[model samples]
Target: MAHDGSDRSGRTEIDHSRRRVLAASGIAIAGSVGVAGCLGDDAGDPFDDYGPQAAALESTAVSWDDLGDLEGELTIYSGRTRDQIDPLFEMIEDEYPDFTVEVDQDGNEDQLNSLREEGENSPADIFYTQSSGALAALKSDGLARELPEDITGAVDDDWSDPDGEWTGASGRVRAIMYDTDEFDGADLPEDIFAYAEDEQFQDVISTRPNSGTFRSFITAMIEMEGEDETRGWVSDMVNQQNATLYSSGSQQAEEVAYGDQDIGLGNQYYAGRILNEDPDATLDVAFTSDDPGCLFNVSGVAILSASDRPNLAAEFTRHILAAEGQEFFVDVNGEYPVIDGVEYVGDLPTVDEINPPSFDLNALGDVEAASDLLREEGMTV
Candidate 1:
């Protein structure tokens, strides 16, 4: 998790001649038309359309019986909503009566900052967050403990930290959400870069460039394709002038589903959430090439370095990695399970088959460059 030391504010203010100036300047700004103010994104409802998981969906990850019960009360500082995590926490309490959890949920980024302020005396035993960026930041701050191989080894190498500080519980993929009423399935293109020239989708697709997911997507795009090319695509979209930015991904997806736009850029899980609220809704996910826009991000857990109950914290992580825990995330929260063997309850392509680009999820912790690109284009996050 190395910082590039590049400052986003250190740019020469440009004189624009419509779209041509940025072409020559080699740095495009999001047009003022559709962007949010470009500073930051508002917190979203992470538990939208959440429900209890299925009765019999078993997990392929470690079993509670295999791990054994060794828990007391543990306090969790969660960067996800209570509804997003309650079902799983309730499951742990019901199965192991002695293990109860007190969860305090807040925005991931804000909570990360708070933890840093608290330092070694932080009361949290477990830190569960919605983005790997927060997890990486914690690890980088020396606030996370290295997990034993028994916990870290349950999931694949890519799903956990390389230095073994955190483990991904569930995953989400970036997607193109299309309005079924506006375009037939074939009209939607899977490749986003190729979609730039698409007539129907031009000037209509929306995203929250300021949102955490959107920033991560753009950062990963920068990693997959160099800065200039990534900037070029955004410039093209900006030149179209109809490419819009939203306050949140779900709102962007809803606008597409409501027919205000033909397509939107958001998490694939968001479409699933819409379907949960309205099964007959016309919203559908149109995936892009496995590069930037379609990259996967995880909501992960880690035992804090300042825990008062380390063993209980680690056991809770085991419960989350178990089959039932994985099922809750896939079925209830509409996420891709990182632990193998849990059946995903949606129409999404299998996680392993998505063919997303290879990049360190940790490296994408800083989305400053991507936000700067959007801001320069005159767009907000």
Candidate 2:
């Protein structure tokens, strides 16, 4: 869908003025209201009525009430599938009759290429994608605009651009998906590198070289351990260890649960998805301590430099950072919320508890180098 060139003149002066004041004062309007106050009596208590999942939405910093009447047209070039992020836009559309969004969902690479090709004429107000590497790539290409301080301040600095180009909307940690029937979490190596060097893990662990998550992991490895070491690790896993390669993280999790493999390199949420489908699944997730295997990658959103409706785009981006938006990610996608105050819903430890090694997330932009190394090592097709 394309923007119809409609203006924001329909919004009330008070709504526009309120947002401006909040932005100027560096106040987070998204997190200012309570859930009950935002929902009102007719909507009732979401936490009490909607059960545990709804509880994640409670005490959120941002509410629909704070956003005011978000009336405008926005075109979002999303790397996440429609089922993953469209519902949030659906909620926004339902809440504000005047607001409408057009989502062009495609692969992250394709979307990034299109944004680059379109240049300043691109209709995309927002670029929502699955990896920080892609967001950084856009920023490096000068396709992204600096977000407002209020929006940037909502999330932790680690998950956002140091230059204020993009902000992480949700997070996932690299974890070892192991078969509960075969081994306990304690039995696994604490360091991810051990799987490549240790004989015990040989021919038992699975990985997805073609997966975006894996590429991002490799990118982090190259940044932290240097390219030579990172390339060697990939080579050892593929050649010496006889590591099995899967098509996707979910497949890796499923294979491990089925006992086809003792362990697999995947994301924490893949296991959460498995349990959600069948609580009795023989799968469990384990994390590596202070290693690249424990890399915390995020699916983030950015405002494009070519966007004409930056204010509306900022509001929508803020909506994703708000309490309800964060809750949707945790409750639906089994991902962690990037903002503070929103409680993590799953069995895994919170982001702070995971405490992934502090690396420059923006450095992940050079994913091409990681991919080249993977190909040179015969890791991908």
Candidate 3:
């Protein structure tokens, strides 16, 4: 496999139509993606501009008033943890005090299951999850409603469902989050296969075996490499290298940063979010020599078909895609903003430069086989 960010890994070279699901950062992809948080109860502009770039930000971002008098309760079944998105809820409250957003956060699979089983009586106005796969699943089941035009149009066409059932709220790039003091990322092998046999990485590595994005990556492997090869590679790497498995990407990055392990196979933002809190922390994110390990997965929102509050539900999605919401997500969570013009904070690579895999994003919806394969290898799913 070539170390440069080119398509020498045997996978098909996808064109722009297929490329819609993924966007690269200028710092990471060098092509697309032109790309922060806060607290408090203020009486001034409910949705005030954020950061130093607030005034200079493009005024095209849809505003709360743009949705036309949104009101009523909005229940959310979210995969994003409370701490990761408190700022979002706070802004919503400050913007529309009459509108209610009650969130019940859980694993994406669990919440997805709830939505599937609940159907019309799900009590969920929105399903906000970490995996586009889950959103795809819901869309396939006819469980999600078509988003309003403004909400759908707020983001790039590729970042949302082709049918407009869901829209990506924020994105995380798959990368090797490493302890900078331990290894120079620039010299790290570009091929993901290197980690399994390369003596330099051996037992010093950590990963999230059950992550939604991890399964998506496995699904891509199944599409790119045969199932047998992906299975063999995973089993060999886990057993041969004595790899340590963590529950979440954040934990994996934390363990590596503290020297519990030297390297972590996880999303790029986990390290950035951690670094913001502890500047002295010896953690930072690095990409694969190219795109092998860099899969771009998104956390997004969808309106539930059963929702009686379509106006409010659409308005919430609208708020999320606009500038105020985009800033809060990027600044606080360190994830990529899906829309252009929003400020991108942190030292992470631009979305275009990360070199995400070319597998069609829409195809990632069904990954039960991949999840089962990971579990069958005696790995946690």
Candidate 4:
């Protein structure tokens, strides 16, 4: 199989439909908020700007105003891309003029290392990351503070830490993104391991071995199937089947849409993004029932234990779990809301409907072991 190296430079343009939906949801308060510049031509009434897609979504039960006033200075170490997270922070800033935020944007590994080095003196009040493994690592290292019941109770038990150290804000599932033009959804196997063992999929599936998401998937596999079995699967894919490599999940989804490959292993949101761009893109996402391929992971948030503004940090964390924050993730990032009653965009099933493998999310923190296995298999440099 040929290697099409990672394209880390390009950023996907924010879907306009998301903006319109957010506007109607009252999370985007265009004219009143500083985001008026980013959102062109406000329709005066936020509801007036929304299209049919926005109209279908029910209004969140708890609005930003319902969260009440938040006043303080909080710094965040965010692993999510600026394009994705900045708008949400901007909304928070606009809503609470007295509350200001400073975001340090970088890769998850880099941010985690920096926090460890800084120890008790780290300036970050919150650590918001795209990987559950990273959040679990923080909890294990004693860098995260226990969250309040109100915050942790908002999401399901599977989405939050058992000890209350961190809570998932939004959900993503591992999926097989395939071109509908080439194959029927029914033709795809429900077991993720089948992609390696089956001959029909050889040299036709693309994967991002270097992504943090992929690493977490491997970690879960190790916990469930043990290292040796996981190692054999990785070895077969890398050394025998010759799986193609891409730099990002989004790119893998795009290539599948273009018929460059029959299928690609990536998160569900990547396909949502492509469909958001063009609903007729000929790409659809499939899941592996009760398998690690359908791992339900989250982009989560945690209050740092060393923060001077613990009260303020807790409030901010709560805000992320609130209806407005949950809707922002669904509308803007195409992610599933971790909280109840917030509808996910597109025709995708709910988190419960996905029925992912049963495992402790915190157990996925052994990403070092996963990375080492990938290196041993020569899947990554």
Select the stronger candidate by TM-score from 1 and 4. 4
RMSD of each: 17.4, 10.2, 12.4, 9.4
- For the record, the alpha-carbon RMSD of candidate 3 to the native fold, in angstroms, is 12.4
Candidate 4 has what TM-score? 0.84
**Model 1 lDDT on a 0 to 1 scale:** 0.69
Give candidate 3 misplaced runs (Cα > 4 Å): 1-60, 63-69, 289-292
User: Each candidate's lDDT (Cα)?
Assistant: 0.69, 0.75, 0.69, 0.76
The per-candidate count of clashes, in order, stands at 10, 4, 14, 0
The digit string of per-residue lDDT tens for model 2 on 61-117 reads: 455456534666779998876556766777677766767788788889889999999
- Between candidates 1 and 2, which one is better according to lDDT? 2
Order the candidates by TM-score, highest first: 4, 2, 3, 1
Better of 2 and 3 by lDDT: 2
Give the per-residue lDDT digits (tens) of candidate 4, residues 1-381: 001233235433334454345557665342321111111112121211221111111123244444435666778999987666777787777767777787888889899999999998998888999888899999998999877666676678888899989988888999999889887998889998898888888888778988888999999998888889899999989878889988877778888998588889988888887787788898898889997899999989988887766666666776676667777787667789886656786656667678798778898776999999899888883
Give the per-residue lDDT digits (tens) of candidate 1, residues 254-320.
7877757877778888787778668788877767766787888888998888875665566568768
Residue 377, candidate 3: C-alpha displacement in angstroms? 1.1
Model 2 residue 5 lDDT? 37
- Minimal lDDT window, size 10, model 4: 48-57
